[model samples]
Target: MSLAHPAHTPDMINIMIVGDSISHGSSGDWTWRYRFWKHLREHGSNIDLVGPKDTLDNIRTAEVGDDDATYADPEFDPDHDAQWGRPYLTEKDEIEAKVREHEPDYLLVLLGINDLFWYGVEPPQFEANLREFVACARRANPGLTIVLGTVLPCRKAVDDPDFGARVDACNNRLRAVAEDLDTPSSPLAVAETAAEFIATEHTWDGTHPNPNGELRIAAAFADALADRFGIGARYPRPYPDVPPVALDAKASID
Candidate 1:
Protein backbone atom coordinates (compact mmCIF):
# COMPACT_ATOMS: atom_id res chain seq x y z
CA MET A 1 0.00 0.00 0.00
CA SER A 2 1.16 3.58 -0.67
CA LEU A 3 2.14 5.72 2.29
CA ALA A 4 -0.51 7.75 4.10
CA HIS A 5 -0.84 11.55 3.85
CA PRO A 6 -2.49 14.41 5.72
CA ALA A 7 -6.17 15.25 5.21
CA HIS A 8 -6.96 16.70 1.78
CA THR A 9 -9.47 16.29 -1.02
CA PRO A 10 -8.72 14.74 -4.42
CA ASP A 11 -8.23 18.22 -5.92
CA MET A 12 -5.76 19.17 -3.17
CA ILE A 13 -2.28 19.84 -4.45
CA ASN A 14 -0.18 16.65 -4.59
CA ILE A 15 3.34 16.30 -5.96
CA MET A 16 6.01 13.69 -6.76
CA ILE A 17 9.68 14.27 -7.58
CA VAL A 18 11.74 11.88 -9.72
CA GLY A 19 15.11 12.19 -11.38
CA ASP A 20 18.90 11.91 -10.94
CA SER A 21 21.53 13.53 -8.62
CA ILE A 22 19.79 16.86 -8.08
CA SER A 23 16.63 15.17 -6.91
CA HIS A 24 18.83 13.02 -4.66
CA GLY A 25 20.36 16.06 -2.94
CA SER A 26 23.90 14.82 -3.58
CA SER A 27 25.45 18.08 -2.38
CA GLY A 28 25.40 17.08 1.30
CA ASP A 29 22.17 18.92 2.04
CA TRP A 30 18.39 18.72 1.77
CA THR A 31 17.67 19.66 -1.80
CA TRP A 32 14.79 21.83 -2.98
CA ARG A 33 12.60 18.77 -3.39
CA TYR A 34 12.34 18.50 0.37
CA ARG A 35 12.27 22.27 0.74
CA PHE A 36 9.24 22.46 -1.56
CA TRP A 37 7.51 19.79 0.51
CA LYS A 38 8.30 21.68 3.68
CA HIS A 39 7.09 24.90 2.13
CA LEU A 40 3.79 23.35 1.07
CA ARG A 41 3.22 21.93 4.51
CA GLU A 42 4.08 25.21 6.19
CA HIS A 43 2.52 27.59 3.70
CA GLY A 44 -0.05 26.03 1.40
CA SER A 45 -3.44 26.00 3.11
CA ASN A 46 -4.75 22.72 1.65
CA ILE A 47 -2.02 21.29 -0.57
CA ASP A 48 -0.91 17.75 0.29
CA LEU A 49 2.09 16.30 -1.52
CA VAL A 50 2.79 12.58 -1.49
CA GLY A 51 4.68 9.93 -3.38
CA PRO A 52 8.03 8.13 -3.04
CA LYS A 53 10.31 8.84 -0.11
CA ASP A 54 13.45 10.97 -0.42
CA THR A 55 15.33 10.50 -3.69
CA LEU A 56 18.83 10.54 -2.23
CA ASP A 57 21.12 7.57 -2.67
CA ASN A 58 23.80 8.48 -0.15
CA ILE A 59 25.62 5.27 -0.73
CA ARG A 60 27.28 5.21 -4.15
CA THR A 61 27.69 1.47 -3.77
CA ALA A 62 25.00 -1.20 -3.97
CA GLU A 63 26.01 -3.05 -0.81
CA VAL A 64 23.25 -4.95 0.97
CA GLY A 65 23.69 -4.02 4.58
CA ASP A 66 22.10 -5.17 7.84
CA ASP A 67 18.44 -4.58 8.66
CA ASP A 68 19.23 -0.89 8.91
CA ALA A 69 20.68 -1.08 5.42
CA THR A 70 17.35 -1.91 3.92
CA TYR A 71 16.18 1.00 1.75
CA ALA A 72 13.02 1.86 3.61
CA ASP A 73 12.59 4.86 1.34
CA PRO A 74 10.53 3.65 -1.59
CA GLU A 75 12.24 6.17 -3.89
CA PHE A 76 15.48 4.25 -3.60
CA ASP A 77 16.27 0.69 -2.62
CA PRO A 78 19.60 -0.56 -1.34
CA ASP A 79 19.34 -3.35 -3.83
CA HIS A 80 18.40 -1.09 -6.75
CA ASP A 81 21.37 -0.90 -9.10
CA ALA A 82 22.09 1.20 -12.17
CA GLN A 83 22.98 -0.86 -15.18
CA TRP A 84 24.24 2.21 -17.03
CA GLY A 85 24.97 5.77 -15.98
CA ARG A 86 24.12 9.15 -17.56
CA PRO A 87 21.56 9.54 -20.24
CA TYR A 88 20.16 6.57 -18.32
CA LEU A 89 17.52 5.48 -20.83
CA THR A 90 19.53 2.30 -20.82
CA GLU A 91 17.70 1.79 -17.53
CA LYS A 92 14.66 3.87 -18.47
CA ASP A 93 12.32 0.91 -18.44
CA GLU A 94 13.31 0.06 -14.88
CA ILE A 95 13.03 3.64 -13.64
CA GLU A 96 9.63 4.07 -15.29
CA ALA A 97 8.40 0.84 -13.76
CA LYS A 98 9.42 1.99 -10.32
CA VAL A 99 7.76 5.40 -10.71
CA ARG A 100 4.58 3.81 -12.05
CA GLU A 101 4.58 1.42 -9.12
CA HIS A 102 4.70 4.45 -6.81
CA GLU A 103 1.76 6.11 -8.62
CA PRO A 104 2.32 9.70 -7.54
CA ASP A 105 -0.34 12.34 -8.14
CA TYR A 106 2.26 14.72 -9.54
CA LEU A 107 5.38 13.41 -11.29
CA LEU A 108 8.51 15.60 -11.46
CA VAL A 109 11.50 14.41 -13.48
CA LEU A 110 15.10 15.76 -13.17
CA LEU A 111 17.53 13.84 -15.36
CA GLY A 112 19.65 13.86 -18.60
CA ILE A 113 23.06 15.01 -17.36
CA ASN A 114 24.30 11.46 -16.90
CA ASP A 115 22.90 10.51 -20.29
CA LEU A 116 24.74 13.39 -21.90
CA PHE A 117 27.91 12.48 -20.05
CA TRP A 118 27.69 8.75 -20.71
CA TYR A 119 26.17 8.20 -24.13
CA GLY A 120 26.26 11.77 -25.43
CA VAL A 121 22.76 11.03 -26.69
CA GLU A 122 21.86 13.56 -29.32
CA PRO A 123 18.74 15.72 -29.34
CA PRO A 124 16.66 13.02 -31.08
CA GLN A 125 17.28 10.40 -28.42
CA PHE A 126 16.73 12.93 -25.67
CA GLU A 127 13.28 13.75 -27.07
CA ALA A 128 12.53 10.05 -27.45
CA ASN A 129 13.41 9.36 -23.86
CA LEU A 130 11.30 12.26 -22.64
CA ARG A 131 8.36 11.26 -24.80
CA GLU A 132 8.54 7.74 -23.52
CA PHE A 133 8.74 8.98 -19.95
CA VAL A 134 5.67 11.18 -20.31
CA ALA A 135 3.71 8.56 -22.20
CA CYS A 136 4.42 5.95 -19.57
CA ALA A 137 3.43 8.26 -16.74
CA ARG A 138 0.17 9.22 -18.42
CA ARG A 139 -0.51 5.60 -19.26
CA ALA A 140 -0.14 4.47 -15.65
CA ASN A 141 -2.22 7.31 -14.20
CA PRO A 142 -4.40 9.13 -16.66
CA GLY A 143 -5.01 12.15 -14.46
CA LEU A 144 -1.46 12.43 -13.11
CA THR A 145 0.22 15.88 -13.11
CA ILE A 146 3.47 15.83 -15.07
CA VAL A 147 6.26 18.35 -14.55
CA LEU A 148 9.52 18.45 -16.49
CA GLY A 149 12.65 20.10 -15.17
CA THR A 150 14.61 21.51 -18.05
CA VAL A 151 17.95 19.73 -18.29
CA LEU A 152 19.98 22.16 -16.18
CA PRO A 153 23.20 23.88 -17.19
CA CYS A 154 26.77 22.80 -16.32
CA ARG A 155 29.86 24.98 -16.47
CA LYS A 156 31.90 21.85 -17.05
CA ALA A 157 29.96 21.53 -20.25
CA VAL A 158 31.63 24.73 -21.37
CA ASP A 159 35.08 23.35 -20.70
CA ASP A 160 35.21 21.67 -24.08
CA PRO A 161 34.24 25.01 -25.72
CA ASP A 162 31.98 22.93 -27.96
CA PHE A 163 30.11 21.61 -24.95
CA GLY A 164 27.96 24.73 -24.66
CA ALA A 165 26.27 24.09 -28.00
CA ARG A 166 25.49 20.54 -27.02
CA VAL A 167 23.94 21.76 -23.80
CA ASP A 168 21.82 24.25 -25.75
CA ALA A 169 20.78 21.58 -28.15
CA CYS A 170 19.71 19.45 -25.24
CA ASN A 171 17.96 22.37 -23.53
CA ASN A 172 16.23 23.29 -26.75
CA ARG A 173 14.93 19.80 -27.05
CA LEU A 174 13.77 19.97 -23.44
CA ARG A 175 11.87 23.19 -24.16
CA ALA A 176 10.14 21.65 -27.13
CA VAL A 177 9.34 18.53 -25.17
CA ALA A 178 7.94 20.60 -22.34
CA GLU A 179 5.73 22.52 -24.77
CA ASP A 180 4.49 19.33 -26.34
CA LEU A 181 3.63 17.77 -23.01
CA ASP A 182 1.80 20.83 -21.68
CA THR A 183 -1.49 20.06 -23.40
CA PRO A 184 -5.04 19.88 -22.05
CA SER A 185 -4.92 16.11 -22.16
CA SER A 186 -1.94 15.70 -19.78
CA PRO A 187 -1.61 19.08 -17.98
CA LEU A 188 2.20 19.26 -18.20
CA ALA A 189 4.23 22.00 -16.57
CA VAL A 190 7.67 22.99 -17.82
CA ALA A 191 9.77 24.05 -14.88
CA GLU A 192 11.99 26.45 -16.74
CA THR A 193 15.45 26.44 -15.11
CA ALA A 194 17.78 28.02 -17.64
CA ALA A 195 16.46 31.56 -17.26
CA GLU A 196 15.69 31.40 -13.57
CA PHE A 197 18.36 29.15 -11.99
CA ILE A 198 22.03 28.27 -12.66
CA ALA A 199 25.12 29.56 -10.92
CA THR A 200 28.34 29.00 -12.80
CA GLU A 201 30.48 29.66 -9.73
CA HIS A 202 28.31 27.60 -7.40
CA THR A 203 28.85 24.37 -9.32
CA TRP A 204 30.99 21.74 -7.56
CA ASP A 205 32.70 20.16 -10.57
CA GLY A 206 31.24 22.12 -13.45
CA THR A 207 28.46 19.51 -13.42
CA HIS A 208 27.17 18.62 -9.96
CA PRO A 209 26.12 21.41 -7.61
CA ASN A 210 27.45 22.31 -4.19
CA PRO A 211 25.01 22.86 -1.32
CA ASN A 212 24.13 26.42 -2.32
CA GLY A 213 23.91 25.40 -5.94
CA GLU A 214 21.53 22.63 -5.02
CA LEU A 215 19.44 25.22 -3.20
CA ARG A 216 19.37 27.26 -6.38
CA ILE A 217 18.16 24.26 -8.33
CA ALA A 218 15.58 23.58 -5.65
CA ALA A 219 14.43 27.17 -5.56
CA ALA A 220 13.82 27.46 -9.26
CA PHE A 221 12.03 24.15 -9.21
CA ALA A 222 9.98 25.26 -6.22
CA ASP A 223 8.96 28.45 -8.00
CA ALA A 224 7.81 26.52 -11.02
CA LEU A 225 5.87 24.10 -8.87
CA ALA A 226 4.21 26.92 -6.98
CA ASP A 227 3.30 28.79 -10.14
CA ARG A 228 1.98 25.69 -11.86
CA PHE A 229 0.09 24.31 -8.87
CA GLY A 230 -1.46 27.63 -7.80
CA ILE A 231 0.10 27.45 -4.36
CA GLY A 232 0.39 30.72 -2.43
CA ALA A 233 3.19 33.31 -2.37
CA ARG A 234 6.74 32.53 -3.40
CA TYR A 235 8.06 29.51 -1.52
CA PRO A 236 11.41 30.12 0.20
CA ARG A 237 13.56 32.28 -2.06
CA PRO A 238 13.96 30.14 -5.16
CA TYR A 239 17.55 29.96 -6.48
CA PRO A 240 18.04 33.73 -6.19
CA ASP A 241 20.12 34.02 -9.34
CA VAL A 242 18.50 34.00 -12.73
CA PRO A 243 20.55 32.48 -15.54
CA PRO A 244 22.34 34.97 -17.78
CA VAL A 245 20.78 35.20 -21.21
CA ALA A 246 24.23 35.19 -22.77
CA LEU A 247 25.29 31.80 -21.46
CA ASP A 248 27.78 30.74 -24.11
CA ALA A 249 25.93 28.65 -26.67
CA LYS A 250 28.80 26.93 -28.44
CA ALA A 251 29.15 23.38 -27.17
CA SER A 252 28.68 20.52 -29.63
CA ILE A 253 27.36 17.00 -29.10
CA ASP A 254 30.47 14.86 -29.01
Candidate 2:
Protein backbone atom coordinates (compact mmCIF):
# COMPACT_ATOMS: atom_id res chain seq x y z
CA MET A 1 0.00 0.00 0.00
CA SER A 2 1.21 3.52 -0.69
CA LEU A 3 1.57 6.14 2.06
CA ALA A 4 -1.58 8.06 2.98
CA HIS A 5 0.04 11.47 2.72
CA PRO A 6 1.55 13.21 -0.25
CA ALA A 7 4.05 10.79 -1.72
CA HIS A 8 7.64 11.49 -0.71
CA THR A 9 10.74 10.63 -2.65
CA PRO A 10 13.55 8.35 -1.53
CA ASP A 11 15.65 11.02 0.17
CA MET A 12 12.90 12.39 2.40
CA ILE A 13 13.77 10.17 5.39
CA ASN A 14 16.90 8.55 6.73
CA ILE A 15 16.84 6.15 9.71
CA MET A 16 19.53 4.73 11.93
CA ILE A 17 18.77 2.12 14.64
CA VAL A 18 21.21 1.51 17.46
CA GLY A 19 21.32 -1.09 20.21
CA ASP A 20 22.78 -4.41 21.29
CA SER A 21 22.55 -7.75 19.45
CA ILE A 22 18.93 -7.05 18.55
CA SER A 23 19.88 -3.96 16.56
CA HIS A 24 22.74 -6.02 15.16
CA GLY A 25 20.32 -8.67 13.83
CA SER A 26 21.21 -11.56 16.17
CA SER A 27 17.48 -12.02 16.59
CA GLY A 28 16.13 -14.35 13.86
CA ASP A 29 17.42 -13.46 10.35
CA TRP A 30 17.50 -9.79 11.32
CA THR A 31 14.02 -9.64 9.81
CA TRP A 32 12.69 -6.80 11.93
CA ARG A 33 15.11 -4.12 10.71
CA TYR A 34 15.35 -5.49 7.18
CA ARG A 35 11.57 -5.65 6.77
CA PHE A 36 11.32 -2.01 7.74
CA TRP A 37 14.08 -1.18 5.32
CA LYS A 38 12.48 -3.20 2.54
CA HIS A 39 9.14 -1.46 2.91
CA LEU A 40 10.74 1.93 2.50
CA ARG A 41 12.79 0.84 -0.49
CA GLU A 42 9.76 -0.70 -2.22
CA HIS A 43 7.91 2.57 -1.76
CA GLY A 44 10.78 4.38 -3.48
CA SER A 45 12.30 5.74 -0.30
CA ASN A 46 15.98 5.90 0.53
CA ILE A 47 17.14 4.73 3.97
CA ASP A 48 20.55 4.88 5.58
CA LEU A 49 21.07 1.95 7.97
CA VAL A 50 23.71 2.18 10.69
CA GLY A 51 24.56 -0.31 13.43
CA PRO A 52 27.55 -2.07 14.93
CA LYS A 53 29.51 -4.60 12.92
CA ASP A 54 29.70 -7.32 15.57
CA THR A 55 28.09 -8.38 18.86
CA LEU A 56 29.84 -5.99 21.16
CA ASP A 57 29.23 -6.11 24.95
CA ASN A 58 26.02 -8.13 24.67
CA ILE A 59 24.77 -10.66 27.28
CA ARG A 60 26.93 -13.71 26.86
CA THR A 61 25.17 -16.23 29.12
CA ALA A 62 21.71 -17.74 29.19
CA GLU A 63 19.77 -17.53 32.43
CA VAL A 64 18.38 -20.93 33.30
CA GLY A 65 15.70 -19.37 35.57
CA ASP A 66 14.60 -16.00 36.94
CA ASP A 67 16.52 -16.67 40.11
CA ASP A 68 19.53 -17.98 38.27
CA ALA A 69 21.63 -14.95 39.28
CA THR A 70 21.74 -11.19 39.15
CA TYR A 71 24.37 -10.32 36.51
CA ALA A 72 26.87 -12.89 35.29
CA ASP A 73 30.26 -12.46 36.84
CA PRO A 74 32.58 -10.88 34.27
CA GLU A 75 34.63 -14.01 33.82
CA PHE A 76 34.81 -16.50 31.02
CA ASP A 77 33.53 -19.97 31.83
CA PRO A 78 34.87 -22.00 28.95
CA ASP A 79 33.05 -25.13 30.06
CA HIS A 80 29.74 -23.26 30.15
CA ASP A 81 30.70 -21.08 27.16
CA ALA A 82 30.00 -17.95 29.19
CA GLN A 83 32.07 -14.81 28.81
CA TRP A 84 33.27 -12.48 31.54
CA GLY A 85 33.16 -9.21 29.58
CA ARG A 86 30.55 -6.41 29.33
CA PRO A 87 28.21 -5.30 26.57
CA TYR A 88 29.25 -2.49 24.20
CA LEU A 89 28.52 1.16 24.94
CA THR A 90 27.91 0.02 28.52
CA GLU A 91 28.79 3.60 29.40
CA LYS A 92 27.36 6.89 28.15
CA ASP A 93 30.63 8.21 26.82
CA GLU A 94 30.85 5.52 24.17
CA ILE A 95 27.36 6.21 22.87
CA GLU A 96 27.93 9.96 22.83
CA ALA A 97 31.01 9.48 20.71
CA LYS A 98 29.18 7.35 18.19
CA VAL A 99 26.15 9.63 17.84
CA ARG A 100 28.38 12.61 17.17
CA GLU A 101 29.86 10.75 14.26
CA HIS A 102 26.75 9.29 12.58
CA GLU A 103 24.25 12.11 13.21
CA PRO A 104 21.30 10.11 11.87
CA ASP A 105 17.84 11.57 11.19
CA TYR A 106 15.93 8.92 13.14
CA LEU A 107 17.62 6.89 15.86
CA LEU A 108 16.11 3.58 17.08
CA VAL A 109 17.69 2.37 20.32
CA LEU A 110 17.05 -1.24 21.55
CA LEU A 111 19.09 -2.33 24.54
CA GLY A 112 19.07 -3.35 28.24
CA ILE A 113 18.38 -7.10 27.98
CA ASN A 114 22.09 -7.66 28.34
CA ASP A 115 22.09 -5.40 31.36
CA LEU A 116 19.25 -7.45 32.81
CA PHE A 117 21.03 -10.66 31.89
CA TRP A 118 24.43 -9.55 33.12
CA TYR A 119 24.42 -6.78 35.72
CA GLY A 120 20.85 -7.16 36.92
CA VAL A 121 20.42 -3.41 36.80
CA GLU A 122 17.09 -2.31 38.24
CA PRO A 123 14.56 -0.03 36.56
CA PRO A 124 16.10 3.15 37.90
CA GLN A 125 19.60 2.54 36.54
CA PHE A 126 18.25 1.27 33.27
CA GLU A 127 16.10 4.37 32.81
CA ALA A 128 18.89 6.66 33.81
CA ASN A 129 21.29 5.07 31.37
CA LEU A 130 18.74 5.06 28.60
CA ARG A 131 17.88 8.66 29.29
CA GLU A 132 21.49 9.54 29.04
CA PHE A 133 21.74 7.78 25.72
CA VAL A 134 18.69 9.60 24.36
CA ALA A 135 19.70 12.97 25.70
CA CYS A 136 23.16 12.76 24.23
CA ALA A 137 21.89 11.67 20.85
CA ARG A 138 19.34 14.45 20.70
CA ARG A 139 21.93 16.94 21.75
CA ALA A 140 24.11 15.88 18.88
CA ASN A 141 21.31 16.53 16.38
CA PRO A 142 18.36 18.59 17.65
CA GLY A 143 15.94 17.47 14.92
CA LEU A 144 16.72 13.79 15.21
CA THR A 145 13.79 11.51 16.13
CA ILE A 146 14.18 8.62 18.55
CA VAL A 147 12.33 5.28 18.73
CA LEU A 148 13.01 3.05 21.73
CA GLY A 149 12.72 -0.66 20.91
CA THR A 150 11.63 -3.02 23.70
CA VAL A 151 13.05 -6.33 24.78
CA LEU A 152 11.21 -9.29 23.26
CA PRO A 153 9.51 -11.89 25.47
CA CYS A 154 11.71 -14.85 26.28
CA ARG A 155 10.85 -18.42 27.22
CA LYS A 156 11.89 -19.06 30.77
CA ALA A 157 15.36 -20.48 30.99
CA VAL A 158 15.37 -23.58 33.16
CA ASP A 159 16.63 -21.26 35.89
CA ASP A 160 14.67 -18.03 35.39
CA PRO A 161 10.94 -17.54 35.87
CA ASP A 162 11.03 -13.73 36.15
CA PHE A 163 12.98 -13.10 32.97
CA GLY A 164 9.91 -12.17 30.96
CA ALA A 165 8.44 -10.13 33.81
CA ARG A 166 11.65 -8.18 34.18
CA VAL A 167 11.54 -7.32 30.53
CA ASP A 168 7.98 -6.08 30.96
CA ALA A 169 9.04 -3.81 33.77
CA CYS A 170 11.82 -2.42 31.64
CA ASN A 171 9.38 -1.64 28.83
CA ASN A 172 7.00 0.05 31.23
CA ARG A 173 9.72 2.25 32.61
CA LEU A 174 10.84 3.12 29.09
CA ARG A 175 7.35 4.24 28.12
CA ALA A 176 7.19 6.55 31.12
CA VAL A 177 10.60 7.92 30.34
CA ALA A 178 9.75 8.48 26.70
CA GLU A 179 6.56 10.31 27.65
CA ASP A 180 8.41 12.49 30.12
CA LEU A 181 10.87 13.34 27.38
CA ASP A 182 8.07 14.59 25.18
CA THR A 183 6.37 17.97 25.51
CA PRO A 184 2.82 18.77 24.41
CA SER A 185 4.33 20.42 21.32
CA SER A 186 7.59 18.61 20.88
CA PRO A 187 8.59 16.64 17.81
CA LEU A 188 10.25 13.75 19.62
CA ALA A 189 8.09 10.59 19.86
CA VAL A 190 8.16 6.96 21.03
CA ALA A 191 7.62 3.71 19.12
CA GLU A 192 6.71 0.47 20.89
CA THR A 193 6.93 -3.18 19.67
CA ALA A 194 6.29 -5.04 22.90
CA ALA A 195 2.72 -5.87 21.98
CA GLU A 196 2.99 -6.08 18.19
CA PHE A 197 5.95 -8.49 18.19
CA ILE A 198 5.95 -10.70 21.29
CA ALA A 199 2.88 -12.73 20.28
CA THR A 200 4.23 -13.80 16.90
CA GLU A 201 6.00 -17.17 16.58
CA HIS A 202 8.76 -15.76 14.39
CA THR A 203 11.52 -15.71 16.94
CA TRP A 204 14.76 -17.40 15.90
CA ASP A 205 15.36 -18.82 19.31
CA GLY A 206 12.74 -18.69 22.04
CA THR A 207 14.34 -15.35 22.98
CA HIS A 208 15.46 -13.59 19.77
CA PRO A 209 12.99 -13.26 16.89
CA ASN A 210 13.43 -14.25 13.23
CA PRO A 211 12.95 -12.14 10.07
CA ASN A 212 9.17 -11.84 10.34
CA GLY A 213 9.55 -10.41 13.81
CA GLU A 214 12.06 -7.91 12.51
CA LEU A 215 9.72 -6.80 9.72
CA ARG A 216 6.96 -6.27 12.21
CA ILE A 217 9.30 -4.24 14.35
CA ALA A 218 10.36 -2.03 11.44
CA ALA A 219 6.81 -1.56 10.25
CA ALA A 220 5.70 -0.67 13.76
CA PHE A 221 8.39 1.99 14.10
CA ALA A 222 7.67 3.42 10.65
CA ASP A 223 3.98 3.61 11.50
CA ALA A 224 4.75 5.28 14.79
CA LEU A 225 6.86 7.92 13.10
CA ALA A 226 4.19 8.55 10.50
CA ASP A 227 1.54 9.00 13.15
CA ARG A 228 3.61 11.27 15.35
CA PHE A 229 5.69 13.29 12.87
CA GLY A 230 3.45 13.15 9.81
CA ILE A 231 6.33 11.56 7.95
CA GLY A 232 4.95 9.49 5.08
CA ALA A 233 4.79 5.78 5.91
CA ARG A 234 7.18 3.20 4.57
CA TYR A 235 4.60 0.39 4.60
CA PRO A 236 1.14 0.78 3.14
CA ARG A 237 -1.24 1.58 5.95
CA PRO A 238 -4.46 -0.50 5.94
CA TYR A 239 -2.33 -3.34 4.67
CA PRO A 240 -4.03 -5.65 2.15
CA ASP A 241 -3.84 -9.31 1.21
CA VAL A 242 -0.51 -10.66 0.01
CA PRO A 243 0.05 -10.23 -3.71
CA PRO A 244 0.83 -13.13 -6.05
CA VAL A 245 4.06 -11.38 -6.99
CA ALA A 246 5.20 -11.49 -3.34
CA LEU A 247 8.20 -13.58 -2.36
CA ASP A 248 7.78 -17.23 -1.39
CA ALA A 249 8.27 -18.18 2.24
CA LYS A 250 12.00 -18.75 1.88
CA ALA A 251 12.73 -16.44 -1.03
CA SER A 252 10.62 -13.62 0.39
CA ILE A 253 12.56 -13.65 3.62
CA ASP A 254 15.94 -14.05 1.96
* Per-prediction TM-score: 0.73, 0.68
Error of 2 at 6 (Å): 22
For residues 1-254, what per-residue lDDT tens digits would candidate 1 score against the true structure?
A: 22335555776655566666555543133445544555555664454444444334433344312112222223211111111233447545654565566656676667787777767777789889878877777777778777777777777565665666777787788778778778776687777655544546656556555555655665666677678766554556434553321212111223
lDDT (0-100) at residue 75 of candidate 1? 28
User: Which residue ranges in model 1 land beyond 4 Å of their true spot?
Assistant: 1-12, 45-55, 59-88, 236-254
User: Across residues 9-114, which tens digit of lDDT does each residue of candidate 2 receive?
Assistant: 5555545566544544321132345556556656555555543332222222253211112111112110110122223237454656566675557776666677
lDDT of every predicted structure (CA atoms): 0.57, 0.54
Q: Please give the distance, in angstroms, between residue 55's alpha carbon in candidate 2 and its true position after superposition.
A: 10
- Best TM-score goes to which candidate? 1
